[model samples]
Target chain A: MSAPIIAIDAMGGDYGPHCIVPACISFLAEHPSLQLVLVGQAPLLEDLIARSSIPALDRQRLHIHHASEVVAMDDRPSQALRGKPDSSMRIALELVRDGKAQACVSAGNTGALMALSRYLLKTLPGIDRPAMVTAVPTQTGSCHLLDLGANVDCSAEHLYQFAIMGAVAAEALGKVRPRVALLNVGTEDIKGNQQVKLAANLLQAASGVNFIGYIEGDGLYRGLADVVVCDGFVGNILLKSSEGLAAMISARLEALFASSLPARAVGLVAMPLLRRLRTELTPAQHNGASFLGLQGIVVKSHGSAGEEGFRSALRRAMIEVRENLPQRLHGRLEHLL
Target chain B: MSAPIIAIDAMGGDYGPHCIVPACISFLAEHPSLQLVLVGQAPLLEDLIARSSIPALDRQRLHIHHASEVVAMDDRPSQALRGKPDSSMRIALELVRDGKAQACVSAGNTGALMALSRYLLKTLPGIDRPAMVTAVPTQTGSCHLLDLGANVDCSAEHLYQFAIMGAVAAEALGKVRPRVALLNVGTEDIKGNQQVKLAANLLQAASGVNFIGYIEGDGLYRGLADVVVCDGFVGNILLKSSEGLAAMISARLEALFASSLPARAVGLVAMPLLRRLRTELTPAQHNGASFLGLQGIVVKSHGSAGEEGFRSALRRAMIEVRENLPQRLHGRLEHLL
Candidate 1:
């Protein structure tokens, strides 16, 4: 049995090939059997690959598929897909569709990646809409949050499906009987809007998934539940706000420790403990955005992701592939839907 | 002119009279002529006040009104007010209603505060509903965010009213021609739901307030606009999530700095810069939550507020009072409505 070929969208993200090339080398070193297909402007990728310290045989495992066009970060997803059919993002999706690559990964415009994935790989049977699942770090550990910016306007049924996909993902990550919760304004059944109230009712009645009641935004970081579910709009707000707030807080703490000599001494002594906590809180360290409910595994790394962040994303993709997450999700959701 | 008699909900908040008493003492120290009527459990308030470090003349400036009941943090605002008329929150609001106190402040159940404030003072004429306006720390400075958890479902007109009030509040803080923005998922005019779109259009056409276009969730902390307006649901999420993330990140950074010797050394040097940043980022340091669109000035401190946090809240209340914000807001919104 040969290794699985993973197509890497090379000409994407803030650091572009600099981060992607190093991450690919790191991944290949850890998984020597892994095959790599780099999709982007070939010259740039080659330049980056040449700078890496990986051996020739390992380099032989890498292939480049030149894509003349690249989608801008701010480009509309559907418009980009329609205009540039041969974009690195689109081509990477094609590789997966054609069985040349088992999965696709991009740190490009999220909208374009999601759109192209849906257009090329298509939604899995029984899945109404594909979801973007990502992990959020909490007090206990990491918890999976689903629909983290796909399907902005979700119906009660949509939320139910998200719970199923999220539960499957959580199980794959080793959380047995993953407690699924519908994110709402409050914990009470009657606390949210009409949509949340209806979703709560449906989630409660559903089986297989461990349907915990409502969890508020605060509970997301408290690690109250294993799986938190919501529509893309709310989830996106949560995801971005959480990330932004983390940055804001980090900045604030730095300022606080710098205020006085006494505080600086405290900060110096507390450095070890602070680093451990920061490692736990950094979102990039915990989860890569996974485009779920697609026929192929498509992980969307953060656009600003650097080498370490991209490495984490690639590692997440490897985990998803090993667990055969898509097949498991389809199996679980097929009959229920 | 006599000093305004302000009613303090003495039994409210996590630290209760312990923090509130000191906050009042500190506030009185600065504003010697200010009068206060403390309402709470009679014996408890008397004991706390007697033990307080406030001077004899300062003590003479305070009058205690005994109430036997208290509202728990988790209690529903409406239900709690109805069930406990003698609750400190209720008595404080009643003091304002009966003309015994010019204004009221509480660090109690937010829902209860809103409900009692409305039930007692009612809405200022032409102000459809009151909004919970709070200050958020931003890169540039602090910005006012209104409807921070008052009315969950707001009409376009209601949002416009919030904008007007927010702008007036900003002006009260000395920001002339404050840039007002309607909070949305995206900045594009066509983006967001019908409510947001309509609100944007209304704000753009409305007179007096300097209406900026749409501002996304990310724009809240960017200081892109002087006054950001949103429905209660989103506002609540933004406010609470900011607080939650701030705490989470602070804790995380502390752990990071303490993780190892090298990190601790780096942390020691970075301590002053970090402290300055943290002070700028801590929302508690800037302003208290204001019940805007009310007939009188009322600020709700965080329920978990300590002495310092309460002092900040009191300072914010003093500023609002000094600026004659409620009158200015009423003047602007009355003609527009």
Candidate 2:
């Protein structure tokens, strides 16, 4: 098989080139057949790359697309996309658009990335909107939540499409006939607003997908359903709130363990258990955010991603490319729309 | 001070009279000044009351308001209220309306309870809509979250009112000048939908409430702000999702601890730390769900609540009654409306 080319937004995340360079070198060392296009200002990218242990052929396999502007983390999505035409994100999307790379990966402004991907690549046939889907680690396993922040206001029909797309994605990850659910105020069919009720009814009767009734917000990290669907607005809230709560709980546990001699002794014996729980909940272990329904693959890394985080994202992108996720999604959803 | 009379929905909740009777008996034993009115079928109420050990005065304090019809958990709120006039929940609400009880407590259908509260007691002065406020256990401490279920579809103006009411409730809990925040997709003023942006702008400028800027969903369990405001719909999703995730995570940890010999050995040492974490995250520790913006005090316990849960609800009801939360909210929000 030919090498899969991935365009990386090197100047994006919190640590930027410092994190991206090492992660890319590490990834390239592990995957000899992989080619990469690192999009950023050449000077800084070169400075970071020069300090890495990536081999000469691996360097030859790497390409640079110089872009001067970097979108700040807080920049508005629409404004950022429109203002920075030659941004790493925009240029990276262009690589996939022009068939230079199989996919684009970024830890940049999430909204801008979504907007640019949609603007440059457009939605796949039969898909009205493209959603950002991410895996949240749960006790049983990780569950996929869709439209995390892509389209805030969605209709029942839009959610139905998300369910189909999400199910397809989950299946690719080995969940055969993944249990699909609409995120609502309660578990009952009649519990939510008109949109949710309408969506629930349609989902209950929908063909092919496993419609597992309504799962509430608290179910997001519980693995209650393999694919939890909601409008971008609610999905985003659930995603962030779960992340915040996990962090808060973890911090509190650390404080309790470090508080006193007895607690410290308890912590020492429980170290293995705590380590397992911590590993189970680590965001890096489940870091990829896929832009579903796009014509080409686009994976979003955390904005604050460091070396390991970026590598995790790259690994995820490679899997999506190998699975031909976008092509499969297009095939499944085309007829539905 | 006169002993406060509280109406208990004895035949409500998942466990119904079993939990309610024990809770009532426990409350009576603890508080000498408390009086109870058990509302349910006469036969069931009488049987449960007869089984209990009570002094003549306490027994006299326990009056039964026979309600033959019972609203099923899945019954539509408006339909159930209109159709089943003599349901336990309806009778409980009527007691408050007739001034027969100072407050009403239930672990029944939350929607039915909210509807009954709105129908019978009506909204207080200057309040357009009622909200269900509950104390959520967080890493820092417990914080008050309003609009947990009521008024799911809300306007910016309604959320502003909710903010005012939430602040008053927080102050009643002794957090002076409580920091109020609008829950949004992002903390930035420019992020989220039009509703969030408009609400954020209004909240930032609002003088009566101590309006902080936006807070993300993850902030809820971390105690980032005292009062986190959102439309009831989103708030309900946040509240329930956090709860579901916490419960699911805890259960998963237990399973992991029992997985193998090494895991079990680790579990023995980690039991205390895990116990402390579990205590911090326990739903019982955060039991009260207050029907805010109502003229009378009404607390909704969880449907499967036991004696301890009901007692917590009773205590919260007493505190709200003592603080005169309704009157304080009325005074604070009258000008804004």
Candidate 3:
């Protein structure tokens, strides 16, 4: 029952400790129970924290773990793995592997994050590879989408595994017997490729899952299902496309509001709701995309995220840590497999 | 210089002739120079057209080419191709092949439309397969996205050909050497799957292509590229997801507006612009997704589209006919290959 320790890769992302330290400080102040270990260059971490002027009580919960080297944004995942052994990303993951931290969060290179996470944490039993999952904002609420970019070329079994992990993960996010569906071109049984059809067959026969049949991309936004499963290739495009569309609509609305006095006056009242609407419709904007099926939680934040965005990632890590998501998946695997 | 004649599959889609016959009548009336042949059950189409009370002059331009059979909504593409030779979708396509119609438009079974079109019209020289391309509304304008749902599993060469076809199609829609990009998860050089990377290499090396590097899904909406190419699976999901997100956003806005009296007053002013916004952002709502790389033009409409949606499809077909899209693509093939 002791306070949970969440590790932050302080030197990750487009902006390093400067963007992340304040987020960690804010997160600690808001949640009195959780502790944070900022892993990065020692002097820089201490300096960033010192400049924050945090209250002494919250500051006590924040600790700095040093790693001399940093993983560059442009470094290849394999290169980052073989080289940069003492990098912040690697060290943060190691802390989780050694049980020093319940979870690790980073805003660095996605491939590097996935590679380091899979290499250091390994996969749960019955899981072939670790898939990335994120809570995509839907109309009614949110749905958990998986394999965001972890395994691009997934087999039917891999998809089935994602469904199980997604259903289990969705439950952790607060849905009972979450309706699981496959992301496909059409809802018809014959609409998709062989892999999707095979995955559908497996889901139908599974004992524990509430298989809801096939769902198209539109269904994802409409909140037709609580858990949507797709291979990394499809999932990545879906997420990125939604993000792009949301951004475009927001820009267009801003331009329209600015065009005329009446429009601008209306926009004065509408701007806040419209902005919230944009965020709600965008799946990727939800910020914390976690690598699922791993031995421990590793949430990937968007690079160049401001303080608010970085804090959202930290909040995501805290949720998984409290839910004990990995252990829950581990517990559910025997039945699903 | 003869007026173009478009063949319509009146018995196709979810609503069949009830939704299509009036659209064809309206199209003929709107464009004085173009003609249309309603290809469906003679008695039903004639009855509906007669009920429309069309003016005699426009009526002369509208003809009926009877289709004795119908393709069921749930019929497989292979089944429709082999079993229903006299079906509305097949007959419309045949009209193009026979030179009686310059182009064909259908809101029928997509698989059937694609299968029958390929079988009747065949692919152009150096073209592996036909792709579905639609004009998706972006913030600034619209971009032509290809492989909407024609080829599920595309090779690197297939993507390369899609780019060429998309570029040519975009020219038909009025863009100069449309900035072509491969649709990917990330814009980075090493972000996507192997096929995408290989396609990127081909596009980069090929002449006559205005390769603008890679574009993520968001770029598709931001109007970053004039032509965005992806495999059918990814493209379909992106389009459908956009449609769903747009619809949800519209519904939420409506609810917000109706929540109070002052909000309703603002809503009255904002409603028309917001309605246009919904249609503009949804790629699937554009109604006419044409099959590119064929020897003849064949456009597919959404199966359950209303009257206006059907007219949009007819309008798309007319554009293709005027542009002589097939001949244009055929002419461009030599330079590209």
Candidate 4:
């Protein structure tokens, strides 16, 4: 098989090429049949590439495409699209759209990435807007949740599309018949708002999707269903809140261990297991969130991610590229429609 | 101030009188000026009460008011109201309404409790609906989050009322000029749906409220604001999801500590600190969730709570009763309107 080329928005995240270049080096070294085009300012990319310890042959597989501008983390999607036509994020997505790369990964402004991706790649037929889908860790395993801040005021039809798209992504990537659920306050049919209630009915009626009634926030982490669907507003809040709670608990645990001499000793002995536990639950393990229902694959990395996190995101993009996830989603959605 | 009398729904929760009676016994012993009325089926409660070793004097402080029926956890609000007219949950609220009790505590079906309480006591003047308000632990301290599972699809006015009610509750109970914020996906004015954005404008323009801008779910636990307002749909999902995530992490931590002999040895030494941590963060420590904007105070405990959890809920009701929270809210809300 020919080597698959992936485009990376090199000057996107908080540390720009500093984070992206090293991650690419590690990824390229691991995957022999992979090529990466780092899209950013040529001078900075060259500087980062020179400093990065990429193996000679792997280095030969790395390419640089200069994009004059970088989208700031806080830039509005409209502003980023209008003012920075040559942005690294836009250029990287453009490469995926033009099939120069199978997929694109960006750690830039989320709003801009979603907007530019939709504008460039367009939504798949019968899809209104692309939903942000991410794999979240649960008790049994990980489950995919969609619309994690893409379209805030989603209609019932929008949610129905999210379920179809989420189920499609789960089946393609997770390799399981996706059990879809609407995220609600209560599991009862009488619970939640009109939109969710309507969405639930649509999901239940839809063929080929395993619509498993309703799931609450707690149920989302319990691995109750394969795909939990919601509007971007609720999904975004749920994702962020889970993150905040995790960080708080971790910080509290650290403080507890550091508070006393005996605790310190316990911490010393338990350090290895604790480290393993942290790695298992940390956000880095699930860094890339896919813009599902798009015409081409686009993965968004957390902007503040370090090398490990960025690499995780790039790896996710690579898997989607290998799976031809966007095309798979198209087929599944077509059959469902 | 006179000794406050709290009416408890002894036949409401999963364990019914077994959990409620013991909690009331402990609560009465702790507070010399406290009185309790355990409302439930007389024979069953009498059997449990008779079996328990209660100090004679404290026993006199507790009273059992008989009710014929119970509200099952799964019963619909409307169904419970129609079919179980003489339910323990209803009788307990009626005691508060009849001026025989200062406050009511229920571990009943939340929907039933909210519906019956609204029907009996009615919302405060200028209030449209009563919101479920609770204090959630954060990095700095606990913050009051409102409409936790009450009105699912909240309009701009409904959210505005929640802000007023939450702020008033915080001031009356939390003893601070609450820093109120509209819960949204993003903190920016341009973010979130039209309802939240409109609520933001209303909150900002309102009088006697410390209207902080938008707060994400993560910020809810960061103690960034004293009162976070959202539609019950989002609020309930957030609350339940947080609970689920906390439980998952705690379970994982336990597994981590018990995985090997060395880990177990470390766990033995860290047991005391871990116990302290658990006590501080457990749901039992913060069991009561208030029904705000109502004419009378009502605290809803977790339906499956044990003795300690039930006691926490009763204690919260006592504190709210002592503060004359409902009356204070009525006065404060008058000016806001």
True C-alpha contacts between chains kept, each model in order: 0.24, 0.77, 0.79, 0.87
Give a tens-digit lDDT track for model 4, residues B93-199: 99999999989999889999999999999999999999988888788888888888889888899999999888877887754777999999888768999899999
Q: Provide the TM-score, chain A, model 3.
A: 0.97
| Candidate number achieving the greatest lDDT relative to the actual structure | 3
Q: How close is candidate 2 to the true structure, as a TM-score?
A: 0.95
| Local accuracy by lDDT, each model | 0.79, 0.81, 0.88, 0.86
Q: Give the TM-score of each candidate.
A: 0.89, 0.95, 0.97, 0.97
- lDDT comparing candidate 1 with the true structure: 0.79
lDDT of 2 by residue, A64-89 (tens): 88988888777777777789887888
DockQ order of candidates, top first: 3, 4, 2, 1
Taken in order, the candidates have interface RMSDs of 3.8, 2.4, 1.1, 1.5
**Better by TM-score, candidate 3 or 1:** 3
What is the C-alpha lDDT profile of model 1 across B1-337, one tens digit per residue? 4687788999888888888887888788788878888889878778887787778988888888988899987788767768887898888888878878777888888878988888888888998899988778776677888887778778998998899899988899888799999877666554566777888888778877799898766666667889999888777766665665565555555566566887667666665565555544556434568899888778898887777778777777777777777787878876887
Candidate 3 lDDT by residue in tens digits, B138-157: 87788888899888889999
**What local lDDT does model 3 show for residue B20?**
87
lDDT of each residue in A1-337, candidate 1, tens digit only: 3588889888888777788888898788889889889999999888888877789889999899999899888788767779997788889889999989888888988878988989899998878789998887876677898887677677888888888889999999899999999887677654766777887877777777688898876677677899998877667666665655565554555566667887677666554555555544556434468988989999988888777778788888888888988988889877667
In model 1, the runs with Cα more than 4 Å from the true position are A43-54, A252-287, B185-191, B212-218, B256-287
* Location of the lowest summed lDDT over 10 successive residues in candidate 1 chain B: B277-286
Models sorted by lDDT, best on top: 3, 4, 2, 1
| lDDT (Cα) of model 2 | 0.81
Cα lDDT for residue A70, candidate 3: 89
